[model samples]
Target: MAGTRVPTLQPSFDELSEPLRETTFVVVDLETTGGSARTERITEIGAVKVRGGQVLGEFATLVDPGRSIPPNITILTGITNAMVVGAPRIDSVLPSFLEFSRNCVLVAHNAGFDMGFLRAACQRLGLPWPAPRVIDTVRLARSALSKDEAPSVRLGALAPLLGATVRPDHRALTDARATVDVLHALFERLGAVGVQSMDELVHAQRRVSTAQRRKRHLAQGLPAAPGVYLFRGAKDEVLYVGTSKNLRQRVRSYFGRSEQRRRIRHMVTLAERVDHVVCAHSLEAQVREQRLIAAHQPRYNRRSKQPHRGWWVVLTSEAFPRLSVVPAQSPQLGRTANPLGPFWSRAAALEAVDALHSAVRIRRCTQRIRRHDPDGTACALAELGKCGAPCAGLESVTDYAAHVMQVTGMVAGSNDDVLTGLHQRVVQLGSAGRFDDAATARDRLAALASVLHRGQRLAALCGIAELVAARPDGSGGWEFSVIRHGRLAGAGVARRGVAPMPIVHLLQASAETVRPAAGPLPAASAEETSTILAWLDQPGTRLVSSTQPWSLPARAAGRWQPFVDAAAVARGSLSGADLRRHAVTG
Candidate 1:
């Protein structure tokens, strides 16, 4: 028994672990009459089918393009019109070639040229194009071999380096056979990157910088869990901040074979180190990423960097209050008119203030006035009854204070009396044929309404001192987060059958102790407020606890349709008239 030889079972190439070894590749080449597929036609076609380095079949045909072959093309390809006089036309030969290459991955050197001619032929005949997965051997060879090793990627230049059995001579069949050999050689080189599947091979053809390849080690230690990653440069400054459900995969993708944005590739090359902070779930990772980006203002991050640059609408504190658009840097404080803001821009904030003035009898003058100063003169706004005229004592302090209270109530989302008065004025102006005045009043009302709605939403979010909410984590479990006065404080996870008390307690202990800002409004940054609002609005998020009362009105004050419609029409007509005038002058 010891001397007896057992049958040695050898593994077949088809049974190898690599998917490319089992894939059928059809290498195609075409001799065309001109450079562009739109104006040219294929004079000849050739294809070679192979698998596991073995040729399965070969196909070659001369196609009559129904046109004279150019002298330049005949000289370059050594194919003459006399050679294809009796040949079958491309329409007759296309069906057979497509049938021969069916269910196979197509391969061509500079694939766009060959594939374009083939597709153009199909389009001309109104035939359904056989959409096959394609690979460009030129790109693959470029990624696999250095320029020093192969100075040119052309089929003629690469054939010798790849040990092609047949040298390309501009004939279609010879070039196709040489391409098959080059493809196999490139496949052998792709093994260095562990490209075992067809999909990976396709992705591996992208040109990857040597620096990017070397820094792939930075991603080796990352955990495959939800977290935020920071890419740091040589000076230890954060270059980019990103969050992902699978940290390792996302980090590794930066070094993968697919081509990335030029800016991202530049950043990756500059990155010296990668650090990460683990989170309980994806939601926490997203919130943390936004916060970090806002805090660091990283060069590679484009969003959430300048939340403080937004504008705010404030009613300046005075004997007679007047709305003003102020920068977010100088927010209104306690007992000094209420602040409603984080408007996208100063223009929007000014529009809101203008709208408010059109609705209420607030002074618009920038001059500081002492109450009941006899020397102070009333402005034209007062003469027009747009202001209470406290500068000239035309309106009593009690009456002016009442009007200020009305404006404050509207900002607080509690009263719509001013809105009602504006609506009546618009109706009266329209009845008297004063359409311009009516449209102006309507514009003001709309602007006021937009700011009121924005303020109400932000205030409601800030009103809650401590909020606990839960949502499905999409893994048969629950994700919980704690928000403290519009800032994400802590987060945790609870499994399906386990008691959530421990997780809840742990989150509360780790939660940041953020003292609520003094005032009826929240003092958090615009980015923070928006993040919390978006999380709370997600479907299936349950509010477990809260300390302050919060609710939005069922209907907003800006719902008046008549004024809104008239304003829209007036603006459109004005714009149309301007366009016509410009046209005539030009």
Candidate 2:
């Protein structure tokens, strides 16, 4: 026993401080009758289990494949039918090999080929296969050695380059032993890149950019919970804002294999720190993310930024009402006027305005006029009877005021007379063979219907000062949210066994009220209102309570019924180009 050292037992992979040195690895190689696992049979199986550079055990066997080995396979692996005639079948030999490689991570040059054969054998024999953690030396070598360092990553080339104790001779045992050496060589290379644990080694195989690797520290300390994360630059300015159900995994992914986008790669390089705001649930996280992106206008975010720039459809408060598209921050209007939309674009709002104008003879002139201003002149549209010519004082103020009332009633979703008039006009145009004009009218009707539907929905939500909603959280609990004036005010979780009344009350009491808008519209932007609507629409969500009343019409008040029928008729007769032109105009 003098001067002789005994091999020490390695620690379990989970408990090991240095898993690369302490975990057991079973390097495997197989010789088969052919390449396909489903069609071919294994002729030989070779595997060597090692830990801390010491051999724990070795498994090798000649398997009787019950079929003829191809000439080419015999020449390559030197495994012939005669040599395996008296050998044990795979079912007899597989149990011993499995025992030898138990509690070890399987390693192979091209693991799919070897593992596929073993799994097939297990399936054919009705044996339970222990699905071990696998590591492919091919992927490891590709990650460890660059193209210049090794022109070819093939096992035969890598075996000699890695200084293997025994060169691969196409035999299973020799190839398996060679692979073990290559695996060790890759571990050594991986250590230089700060990969020590088995998990780190596996993750290192992904091709990550140098900048992303350098910023890995920014992801540290991110909690594994639902939250919104902000990637801040060197000056602490937010570069990106995102939400995730699992903050730690999501943020860490930016430095790991999943981050392949070039823009995100560049963002990672600029990000100096990642800050997060934890949320009780994913819905809350999403709301917070949208709010943060809208507030900070992070450089990397493309959508939902500049919500204040949205457009609205408003009826001017003149003696003769005219619909117009105005910015969200438009100047104060007359007391008689009513605003309907926070539409995504001015063009979209204009489509709705044109729909109403075509049906009613409200003045289309843009100039502001006093009741009896004599200098006002009638535009050509007035001469053609398209307008009542209130500018030229051709129509009485009483008649114009009546038209204005009808327009206001339509916007308020209380009447559909204007829509009915537009539908009649569309039918007349189509019967007269003016298909293009008919198509235009149909498009305007659709635009108006869409805007009115959205406006009614948003107004109903905004009219509520306080509302509570809850839905199943998939964890034997309920997720609750509180809204104040169409904005998310608070959110929380309630367990299954406990009464949710207290939690609901707590959320309701904590909910913050948004400041009322000076105009008729809600202060919340379209994006904010949409976010709240989406949460409310989730399956199983129910209104627990509300302080203010809410009611949406069972159907829109506009001549929507006639418009629908007219659209159906127009669609059947109009050319595809005409229909598309109308759609694109909206």
Candidate 3:
């Protein structure tokens, strides 16, 4: 089997038809005159055809590179100009090599480099160069061997580490045999490491190389320093938006894993380009990410704003600001007294108003009833004091209109002034010795304090958290959380057609509670707390607070505030001082 030329085993097609009993690989090595693709030539080619991971045959030949061999390369590979003066060139030998590589995964050390050279050579020779996939043993070895076992990943270093006996030869066929032996050793190691498929093996190599490169890059500089990283698909669509304290490091993680690299490879193959924006602060990067996510709606972003639905309407023309539900129609301002909806549906609007009526006194019947039926008593709700006595025709429409105004003002959340006025009334009651009414006012203040206290939770998390209350259909409510930096923060959805006041307070509470820990924030140079606060102050940004709870429609009450401070408490970062500062006492 050694020098006497073990006859090349060429099994008949029928014998080869049985399912392979072992894994099969084709081991190959090329000896070239130089490294440059333009000037180099394959002076010697060697391959061992394997079946079921067993070497079946070996092919070896010397090729006339057509150009004179470099003196240094001749010294290195021991294939001199005289040696291949009359040998068949690559054009003549490529046909047999392709046939040998047929139906098998090609194996080599640094396989891509070798394949690149082979493809270039084949292209030059006008050969078809079959697009056969290949396996790289160098990559396999990186994951297989302990760092201390081999000084380098070179073929010479691997031969001894594998302990596969081979002649001390660098000639084409000898080197090919050694590589095949080394490859089998690597396959054994890979099997031990749970690698099973050709694709898995190749993918493992890609991950190893990528991870190594990433680690190297990180070591060269601070990874979490600050910046924006962009991921783009082959078609140049943004795939993901991320900001990091260390842009270099975070970007590398996406490319370092086999699964992630596979996705990136898919993207890169389709990608026409790449772009990135470096920022002075991570908050700025976050703002940009949100803006982009809203703008482009990239597929990878977690928080996508869907169109809002559900609305509440009140007719101003009616004396009591007749509350009603409206279906989602084209966007238009409410008719004078009739505020069109924020209701998800007419039914939801009815349910909401009913629930609010129970929580806070609001009349629901129309005045037109008692006007026409002056003799009959008012509707049942009117009898129950749930509706003004307009139905009984006892109360004038003008007087009925005052109660309706109260209902609308209470529901809109814009009546903070009213709440303050109510607080003043509580003081007045306390002075007048109206203990019960004073106690009720005190309770309301406590509720407001509870609402404001919720904002204390934001300090423990690592990122910016935002809560958005949206009606998916302009009627019903949906809640969302926007986590930026490294914290969890979210706000509850506001009921449709409610004044944006509660929503605004809710956002404020979310920000206060879920803000990242007061450590060095990511990309702090680009954005500050003031910047984020200013952005929050923008029009249409919603908030929530408990100050006007009873006045709020029931639909808006279900949305819960995200408590980020709980995490901070668990972490010991929310010290007594922090908690005291955040806690509100009535």
Candidate 4:
């Protein structure tokens, strides 16, 4: 036993892979009435079944597309409308094709087109799509054959070179037969390059990098739990961070050919170790991932670079209050009466502020205003009668105080002056045939209403010191969350036989102590709090207990539904040209 090393048992992902020689390939081809999967219908289905180079059987059928074939498509595919007069419809034929291709890997030239039609048919017929393994001959040919050997990967071009007996002429059966020959030719080429398993054949179209293939060693013993995962480089720098419902399967996928992202592949290559944090629930995993991203700020993670860039509308505390849009965060939330939002855009926050301006003529300028105006002069807005002219002392402090009270009530989720004013203005504009002005007013209403709704909901939850919520975890157990100040303070699962209240108390005891932040998101980041709110809103969640009253806001955004829906519809209806115009103008 001297100078001997005992080997540690490391699980290999490839242990589950079956050999290619035993694998069945259903080389398929489809003739369609048109190119679009949504609009067009399948005209013909042809599949040749093969195992280890021996032909087992074939399934070929003409489908009644249920519509007239376009002349161009008919001319191209040679499948005339008259030819499919008595043919079975796709619904009638799908069951038989499903039976034939069962447990077989699908091979096709430009697989997306054929698979799109097939999957769409499954969806339209209210049948589940058996998500089968797919291999595209086009990609395979590109990988195996050089441009000098074959100028094009088209079936017509390669059928002769690959020694295919059947020539492709756009007919489904002929093309399907030709595809089988192409598949075998590519398989033989792949064999020389050491590809010999079902997994390898499926992935041979695009080879996974050597670094990716070798890095499976780093994925050993990853737990099958909801968690955050980190890929750390040799220098102990965190290269990337991500979360998954099944950490083991998700991390293993990174070392496989399915991971096609250039950045991810490079990250895997540079990765020296895989680190993970297992969480009791998805909410915890998500929050942890976000926190880790903020702490480490890994170069590969693109989303959370500027985590607190979301905009919030705040009211300045001064002689004459003005609406101030600040980035929603602790540091940015200075001297405001309950900041309004994480509005996603500065222009949208400004729009909401302007909506309030329309209702109460607050000063819309950044210039400092004194109670006693020394200049006694007005700006352009005041001259045009748009502003109350606080700088010019045209509006008294008492008058402005009343307007500021309405603004504060709105901010505290108690007033709807902005909503009422904007909605009525939209109605007035519509009646007067000022359609464009009405639409503008409607957009402002929607923006402000949405922000108010979210702010109110968040504030109600954040106001609570401790709240317990429970939902069935779908497997005879209760999933519980202890929320303190809008953030997920604690989360755990209680089995069926256990006393749930005892577990609830334990969760409360172990929960993170959240300090109230100055802004709407009191305990955690907006992203984390929003995710928790969504979890609690799921249909079956029950409020187990609460320390404080969690009541809804006084003025709900529900009354402004008409303008909100119209705004949504208008946004959805905007053409690409209109979108481009808006983007440029905004």
Best candidate according to TM-score? 1
- Residue 119 of candidate 2: its Cα lDDT? 93
**For all the candidates, what are their Cα RMSDs to the real structure?**
9.2, 9.8, 25.3, 9.3
lDDT of 4 at 518: 66
State the TM-score for model 4: 0.70
Ranking by lDDT: 4, 2, 1, 3
Worst 10 residues of 3 by lDDT: 1-10
Per residue, candidate 2 scores C-alpha lDDT tens digits across 1-586 of 0011112233332333347778899999999999998999999988999998889888888999999999999999888889999999887899888888888899999999999999998899898889998889898888778789899999999988988778998899989999988888888877765566776667776788777877877766777667899999999999999999878667767876567788988999999999998787877888788889989999988887886677776777665567777788777522324576767888887777777777778777788767775457888888788898877778877878888777777767777678778767777777777767877787777667767766777778878887888888786778888877787778887866767888787776666656766554455666777788888877888888888667865445433645555566656665676664443221
Q: Candidate 3, residues 1-586: lDDT per residue as tens digits?
A: 0000111223332232222334466788888877766767788888888866667988889988898888888778777888898899788898888887887778887787678778998899788778876878887787777678766888888888898677437687787788877877886876543344453455556545333333222222323334556566666688766677555444444433354545444443343333455543334466555656556766656653222233444543544345555533323322333242334356645654544454343456544454443554667876676665665667766776666655444433323333344456556766776655455454444333232222112121123343332223234432222334433233233344545445544454545243333322222211223245444444544433222211232322112122223323422443444433333212
Residue 153 of model 4 has an lDDT of 88
Work out the TM-score per prediction. Answer: 0.76, 0.74, 0.38, 0.70
**Cα-based RMSD of candidate 4:** 9.3
How many backbone clashes can be found in candidate 4? 0
Q: Give the residue spans of candidate 3 off by over 4 A.
A: 1-23, 208-257, 261-586
Candidate number that wins on lDDT, 1 or 2: 2
What is the overall TM-score of model 3 with all chains considered together?
Answer: 0.38
Question: Which is the leading candidate under lDDT?
Answer: 4
Sort the predicted structures by TM-score, highest score first.
1, 2, 4, 3
